[model samples]
Target: MRAQSSATGRTAKAVTPPHAPSSARPAGRGAGTGAGTALALSGVFCFSLTFPSTVWGLESFGPWSLVALRGVLAAAVAGAFLLMWRVPLPDRRHWAGLAVVGGGVVIGFPLLTTLALGTSSTAHAAVVVGLLPLTTALFAALRTGRRPSRPFWAAAVAGAAVVAAFTWQQSGGALSVGDLYLFGALLVCAAGYTEGGRLASRMPGWQVVGWALVLCLPVTVAGSAVALALEPVHWSAHGAVGLAWVAAGSTFLGLYVWYRGMAGIGVARASQLQLAQPLMTLAWSYGLLGEELTWAAPLAAAGVLICIAVTQRACD
Candidate 1:
């Protein structure tokens, strides 16, 4: 969706109509499409642990403080990468896109999810994130102008419905504010994913994220410092470790590949693979958070996978 242009003075605008036909795309993306998909899946797997890790971190760190710390840590890593690689500064056109990516992923989604998971169960948060792929695809469609087939929408909606129903049942047939937080997380995360995907098509995946993080570094550093000072933390080793892992994996490396995959395969197809994330979260809950996996978890996983597979097979 993104191609480098000689003109670089304006806020980034879609170069082509977002609803253009797939046949309109150029062919250079083919060489790395498969690799990108693999990388995206790997990113997803790494991200699956984020919820459980957040739950752990919340045991010692305040939600805002934890968020700030994670962002700062992640910014450090991203800054190092950009410096080591001597990544060229983004031009004005690309700067707008990078800002969108930074706002969505680097700042918005992390802050929201951290706050949400402070009160919500890791397992529940994971299941809720299952909504992400559909939302991500939606943003991709809007931005790139390629549409999913009707059947794709159907399966996607059904899968979301299944998750919603299960969540309602689990919560005693009532929804709560946490669901709202998760939904908010979904929106911002999808926006980030969409913008990053667009940018990834024109640059190296790692550099895209590194630059975004570097772009946000100033705010992230100040925010974390203020949060830590304003609210005292319990400061456990477990929380520190959890925070570090999320900073390194979820905040940086995972996004590096995720954007690449979305750029390579088209967001709709690439995103369907995120159906596995909730199940992976469930596993992490059991193993790391010591939550018992219920029979319903496996059933839900199977159902979501089937729906995603159906969605993936649809012809646009």
Candidate 2:
């Protein structure tokens, strides 16, 4: 659900140097920050809509079926963009990396998240996903051999504690197993983001994302076919609309903007903006799904935002 670059073609920020650390200040740092922040906030809003849409669509569709349709639709849209742009096909060396990232981001995250939301509330899913920045930071540190500042670690720990406390309170002493699955999905998403950021530094961000989707098209199509074969099809107007929104807004445009931002801002700091997602999602749940806004919502939102700010400031 990231910001779609306007059709009028804004200038892209130059990719960061490979030798630069993931947390290094970006070129055109101010502009990059503004653009990335805007895109990330937009993504949060767009992504917030996805859970409700998933819930709506799932009323008539199986979770895997919904996931499969999302992949196929998103891949088709992205493939069209590639063709329109005349983007060259990725080289053989990139195929494996693209497959892994596509599988994680396009297939794994959506499926697990939809499944998790089947049992958990959208608010619960949002709160769990707020931890993505922390997960991404941890992975970046491990991958780059760059130790995070003490403040970063402290913020991450504090954020996790807040999330745990909030989840426990919300669940009435029993932790929802679905929350665990969301956490796993976030971890996989973090890995994909980290690797994709590295790749974006070397290639055009659009190219990286575009080629990955192209490589993923066959797998996504086959998966969709299998799901269709297994499940009874009962497509409704509401379901069709939801699927289109998820495909266009969440998957295609979202990844495009996210990758573009990652190319300029690098993974760690860029990932911090993801903390806003849960807050945005909470707002969406209240407005769109008529979910009640409880005390925990504000507390969790503030805690995560503070953690993200602290960590990002420390990195800067």
Candidate 3:
């Protein structure tokens, strides 16, 4: 997930120019920090609901249907927004990066995670995905040529260790097929997040995701048609709502804010905020799916939150 701007294709205005007067610097910095943090947190909240929503969707839609339909549906919404604002196509030079974003975020992650949810409980899948923040930070560092502080790495590592330990304990120390799918999702999604954050610095965060979704429209449309034909639909209220949330809330809106936040705050710090996401998903799973909440949840959540605080303070 990803940054902010107007519907008319403006980039984020939160950044303070290096040429700005010293007297104006502090206020500009403060505003940018506050807005960036809020946007990142909003994205986290939207994503936290995804696993539970996917589980609910699986009740009526097959994994393939759920994944393809979510993409198609999200694309339609993004396409409409782009047209409404007359957003121009991205530059040719940016297409390769956009392809990575489209392939990974729009295609790879959703498909793999949906498949994983078939066998794994939302809580288990969520904790596994908790590895995403660190993965994304590593990707951002390599791709964007920005290095975070050693303290930040220490906190990020500690958080990942907590999540890994929790997943291992929950899964009885054996990797399931679902775990394999989730790990795959983690790697691809991290690449997408890092690239999306880079692109957001040049364009509106919403447009980066908007264009990526639009770029995948052809494949998603075809996939949706074929998947709907093959998958048996058993539609219900939960299924309908679940599909709607994943498509609208998680895919488009979540990514828009997330990319913008990354542009505002830097990808590494924005990603650390996601340490809260798995815990939020755990709560959603318990409440929405009535899945058993384990005793390990509180311990893991506390550890992750402390890590988040440390990383946030550790500086870029």
> What lDDT is obtained when candidate 3 is compared to the true structure?
0.86
Estimate, for each residue in 1-316, the C-alpha lDDT of model 1 and write its tens digit: 4433346544443343355323123322664666656777888888998888888788788888888788888889978766654445565578888888888888888888888776677887888788888898899899889888889989888888878777787778877778778889899888888888877777666767878888888898888888888877887888888898889988887887677666777677878889889988888898888887667766776678788678767833
Model 2 regions more than 4 Å off: 1-31
Give the Cα lDDT of each candidate: 0.78, 0.74, 0.86
Model 3 C-alpha lDDT per residue in residues 149-253, reported as the tens digit of each score: 899999999999998898888889988999999999999999999999888877778878989999898998899899989999998999999999999999999
Question: Clashing residue pairs, candidate 2?
Answer: 1-43, 2-43
Query: Which model, 2 or 3, shows the larger TM-score?
Result: 3
How many clashing pairs per prediction, in order?
3, 2, 7
For model 2, residues 1-316, the per-residue Cα lDDT tens digits are 0112334344433334456323223222444667766655565666767787887778667888888888888878777766654444554566677776787788778888988988998988888787788888888788767677788788887887787788888888987789878988988888878777767665556566666777677877888889878978687877777787877778777776676676666677777777777888788788878887788977897888778788778777
- Candidate 2 matches the true fold with a TM-score of 0.85
How should the candidates be ordered by TM-score, best one leading?
3, 1, 2
TM-score of each: 0.88, 0.85, 0.90
Instruction: Extract clashing residue pairs from model 3.
Output: 2-258, 2-259, 2-260, 3-259, 3-260, 3-261, 4-260
Which runs in model 3 stand beyond 4 Å of their true positions? 1-31
